[model samples]
Target chain A: MNAYPSKLVERAVEQLSTLPGIGRKTALRLALHLLSRPKLDTHTFAHALTEMRDGIIYCRQCHNISDTELCSICASPSRDTSTICVVQHVGDVLAIENTGQYRGVYHVLGGVISPIDGIGPEELLIDELIERVRSGTVKEVILALGTTMEGDTTNFFLYRRLQDFSIKVSVIARGIAIGDEIEYTDEVTLGRSILTRTDFDQSIRF
Target chain B: MNAYPSKLVERAVEQLSTLPGIGRKTALRLALHLLSRPKLDTHTFAHALTEMRDGIIYCRQCHNISDTELCSICASPSRDTSTICVVQHVGDVLAIENTGQYRGVYHVLGGVISPIDGIGPEELLIDELIERVRSGTVKEVILALGTTMEGDTTNFFLYRRLQDFSIKVSVIARGIAIGDEIEYTDEVTLGRSILTRTDFDQSIRF
Candidate 1:
């Protein structure tokens, strides 16, 4: 690697490269871009990140990121308190919210159970979810996690834990996407779609 | 766009997405990734950017980013001060440095002369470069700008400005890259390589 002319530039690049997808070249580009802009703009950008990191809170009820004790969905009276969508991360909560179809609040697990990665139920918010369900307020728990091995393990684990509770548990449907061609769909997904096909009316409603 | 659950999250995504290649989706990803890590890590990252923006200086001699009045390269006596490589940005200086080929100091022009972008000689460090050359310390000025129209325009403009000074003005060579096949080479580059074929001895040295 070429030594950066300025230590400040070097530090900025190093810090930025730590982000999930950003590499050294991209980090350098981002640093230089911030340098090229007005000082106030960069200050604002930095301030936003700092504020988010230091001030943002997780909802007490759902573990979703929020500016208050409860996330917007959990705080709002219109949202269904009886139903909860359990997800692996805050990003998944955001993704489900973007759909605008689900009226329920979310429970962010923080991470799924991954044996190789050493992540287990204890590392996630699984205990909090069980407590919330045991309160007798929640009637349904939607498993919105991915189809990966880790996600499946977490789902089964959660299912076993919630079995004693009176609440109904459901997994998000998995199949070919709405507009995806049948020929392009994977064999396993296609086979599963055929076996667990929903009613045409229900599918059209979605 | 779906409204982010938290105002802080929304603001961070807005600020991050303003970067050159980052879109809203990527910005959200980055923001969530930062939130996933320890608060100290994000603070350090934000501090680095803020410090770089507010504390970084431009070299008095070459206009390169620096912590002091003079950049490290410009201050180092071991570097060839008599020969100056002119580039449009600090990234170029880093790129050249990575090659470990160029031993001379650099003159960062800040940007190329671009009429469409309203970037001209006045916006660049051309005046400082001219003053440096007029001091009679430089022997050669290497135009290491890009192969774009703006690059060529800036090169010609610099050449005209340096005509009065008793110094050799040259451009970095352009040709098919080493290990690149002729069949895959662009027509203009192939034509240029043929037109500006170098001596066998010099070519072998490179």
Candidate 2:
């Protein structure tokens, strides 16, 4: 054990070290810094974590994080109810919303099915998503997931489950990112881009 | 404002981002991770910070962080009272104590005098240090501070103040670090090592 003069400080450092990327040395620095500040700073910090954890709720409609029964995006009248974007987490929903290009709402799957991690379809909100689709309101289900094996596995699983419905299912485009030099592009992505080329008539915009 | 799905999450991120080295993106990740865990985890983390901040105190003798009036080092009977090591923070005390080579007690100055940061000698525990020296128990005061400009300035100021006393004042030796290559050592450190080389008769120990 490092020579922490106070037991309180040792406990604080222990708890802080559990956070991602924070080691014992950095935990000590943060603990000492918090100790040096006014009491109100730590008070607010503590309250924020505690209150947010205790008071927060998951959205009933799409399973995104929410403070109410429905998230703001799901509750918005302008959002397209006909298309539901499928994602692995609430963060993905926020990322798509930030682009402002997708006017459709989203359905958070909580996580992808991974047999190694013991996560099955039952563990995710797949049933609720099926229930939503079975209501006969949605026209399209977009698979905006990573190209990793687990993501593809989940996408295929969802595609099979939603096969009974007469809805369109599409995966997000896989290509070299904008502004990426052609010489630096990976072989697999560049090959796929060439094999599945799309129309070049799309308007050029930032 | 980044699109945090919930106001509670946004508030948590805002508070978490205030810590050193934690930016908005890392803060969001942390907030989401905390939310994903059981409520007890965040409760413990929050309680640790609040309890430590509210209950911690500075030792009366050494001014190191303490839960009691006197720090453990100051209260220990086996420690030497004749020599006192002056440090800038509690972390430095831990660093010196880890070596297990020094048995002397420590005096934490809180910080060094840095005119650029508006930190004066009065803002530190210099007066308390002088009072400790005046008690006539200490015979030597070791300056175990960084080699920064502010550290040098503080050392000179302390030297001037202790000029009236009949005590030995010394600084920790500066040399190339262990495992460092001689060729890669900076010019200033190499020059100082050459100027102040010690006797080789001492046994080389791991």
Top TM-score model: 1
Docking quality tier of candidate 2? medium
| Per-residue C-alpha lDDT of model 1 across residues A95-124, encoded as one tens digit per residue | 887787899888989889997988867988
Per-prediction DockQ comes to 0.80, 0.74
TM-score of chain B as predicted in candidate 1: 0.96
Which ten residues in a row are the worst by lDDT in model 1 chain A?
A: A92-101
Query: Candidate 1 DockQ score?
Result: 0.80
What TM-score goes with each of the models? Answer: 0.94, 0.93
DockQ-based class of model 1 = high
For all candidates in order, state the fraction of native interface contacts they contain: 0.90, 0.82
Instruction: Candidate 1: list runs displaced more than 4 Å.
Output: A200-206
Steric collisions counted per model: 0, 0
Give the number of the best model, judged by DockQ. Answer: 1
lDDT of 1 by residue, B69-169 (tens): 98889999789999999999989999999999998999999989999999979999999999999897899999999999999999999999999999999
The residue pairs that clash in candidate 2, if any, are none
Give the per-residue Cα lDDT of candidate 1 at A181: 100
